[model samples]
Target chain A: MEDNVKKIMHVMRRAPHGSIYTYEGLEMILIMAAYEQDLSIAFIGDGVYALKKNQDTEGISMKGFAKTFMALDGYDVEKLYVDRVSLEERGLTEDDLLVDVELLDSVEIGRRMTEQDVVIHH
Target chain B: MSHRFLATILNSDKVKIGILLKEGPYNHQAADTAYKFAEAAIKKGHTVDAVFLYNDGVINATNLTDPPQDDRNIADRWSKMAKEHGVEILACIAASKRRGITDDIMIDGGSITGLGTLTDIAIRNDRLLTFGD
Candidate 1:
């Protein structure tokens, strides 16, 4: 008999994506990893900015928390997904992002969310 | 022990829902939306075990919310509903203290807890829905 695996999904769908929300989402992912929980991230709407490259926080005097997205891969956080429609709406491409991500369509994203044992929306 | 195990198995069909409220009842629309969702979830036969109030949401737990004559007193309404339903309404201790929310009011099932409690709900619950702007 096989063991029941618990899968968790984090859905990011905020606009004007500020530091606090970004930090909270990343912290959740890290904490899940530390506990050996299965975790995945899905970026929707303006939430994609958290993974964008060349984020110049110098003007805002904000801490460089965007760099944490790059460190996600090192934390065994490989399931980074971006909504394809949202990416195109924002005029962004794979090259515009700091981390490599799997672009998913609406149907595929819904299917994935429904398949998870736990789903967290931020 | 077997009966308890059977009950657990039967309840497994129901989803464990944790609602994270980050905003206060100052906005009537947001409060109305949350209440409607909670009502709808009950109507749909899904169990809502807990509601974790964080950040500005600590304001909702305060006993001093007084809205205008024209607008609905959402905070009071939430408190009443929560009391009647026996719902677990946990206000984050760190957030509540920072926002000057003291333990004066008698909000049934609502208490000031820590972030660790929220993390426990996140891990144990089947769905952690966050309500933020």
Candidate 2:
């Protein structure tokens, strides 16, 4: 634990594959992970769809990076937060997600967000 | 004046901000908003350390850009703003190469740098604000 480890929270609000925002957001996260910052990801709104199980992108010709979410632990980016309401709205639970995450309400997530040094919404 | 008001006015904690622009000019309002935000931050006594252009945002640093006579030239605006404020306008090298943004086409006060620079900007700055679609 370095003294200058800044808490960086990346909030993903967009759905995967619909646009490049989520994919590119993930790319940015991956790059920043190498910096050894205290990084956390929050999936709000359609962002939860990014972690849904069994994402088949073969038909769209797009490279499926959904599995990459599971690899965040390897980069020391283990704090994955999924909005509870968002998951329920989409008729999904923790079991539907491909990776293990802390299912929290928006209030808790908002509090955690304020504690961060930087918050990037995508 | 109230104590809180006086405290706020006397506060010297000016945040060092670094902007990350991921959208291109014209197609999105991200560039325009980021430019305006940077301008406002400078005016408010905050130091805008750098503007790291990534993805399509690297296109905003090209000198060969030609906008309509009535339109505001985004590249020219960024170049002039950076020159005046001493803000480093950096475009990601990989993204630039893919988008045909060579050094010869780089605007004044702008340069092509690697993602490592972006990482440094994010780490060094007090706030790393991102503007995109």
Candidate 3:
């Protein structure tokens, strides 16, 4: 990786489906991944719910893109960090998530966020 | 002489900012806050490269918007601000297509473009600020 490659971090603080922020944030991430930047995603608060397994959106008539998280690695956007406190608060574990993610404490996530060139919260 | 040198340094430190708005007008305060922030940044001698409208924010660029006589016209405000500052007001093509926003229906200074354009804006600008619901 070049020194000029920006470290961009997208912070997902909302749950999926209730609002369009998380879904649209994913869309933005997918686009930015093509630029070959050092991109990472942080799942905090209700954002941890977005990666939950077996999301059935058929009854809600919304497109189920939960599986899309699994495809991010192919685009070279493999850094998915989850907030450990948030997951425990919601009674969710790594097994409950659809994709593999680095479970880090909030302090660690904050440190990484401070190191980013760009931080976008959704 | 020292004050003049400091002023030059301060002026040279001005950053290029790109704003990403993800909500529509009226329903949220994101558009208003973004507009004010853009205005303030420009007043502070910074360059606002562009305002990228995503998702429901495409409505901010539509020409068909007509607020009440007593209300502030959000689209017109964006158009006026863009014209005055030479700022590019771009709405995501995909988002516009879903929201019935076409080229003909866009405000004078606003245009519909692809997400690639947004990527370029983000990469080129020194700061990328996002405002949404």
Q: What is the DockQ of each candidate?
A: 0.26, 0.48, 0.59
Docking class of 3: medium
Best by lDDT: 3
lDDT of 2 by residue, A4-119 (tens): 88888999998999887788788888888998888999999999999999999999999999989999889999999999999999999999999999999889999999999888
For residues B55-129, could you state the per-residue lDDT of candidate 1 as single tens digits?
A: 677778877776778977766666766777656788877667767887786264568887667667777767777
Best of the two (1, 3) by lDDT: 3
Checking candidate 2 for backbone clashes, the offending pairs are none
Q: Which parts of model 3 have CA positions greater than 4 angstroms off?
A: A1-3, B1-10
- Pick out the ten consecutive residues of candidate 2 chain B with the lowest summed lDDT: B6-15
Candidate number achieving the greatest TM-score relative to the actual structure: 3
Query: lDDT per residue, candidate 3, A1-122, as tens digits?
Result: 68767889999999999988889889989998998889999999999999999999999999988988889999999899999999999999999999999999989999999998789888
Error of 3 at A62 (Å): 1.6
Per-residue alpha-carbon lDDT of candidate 1 for residues A1-122, written as tens digits (9 for 90 to 100): 12333577887776424636666556656766655557799999888877788878788776677778788888888898999999999999999998889999989988998877777666
Q: Give candidate 3's error at residue A8 in angstroms.
A: 0.9
Model 1 residue B57 CA deviation (Å) reads 2.8
Ranking by TM-score: 3, 2, 1
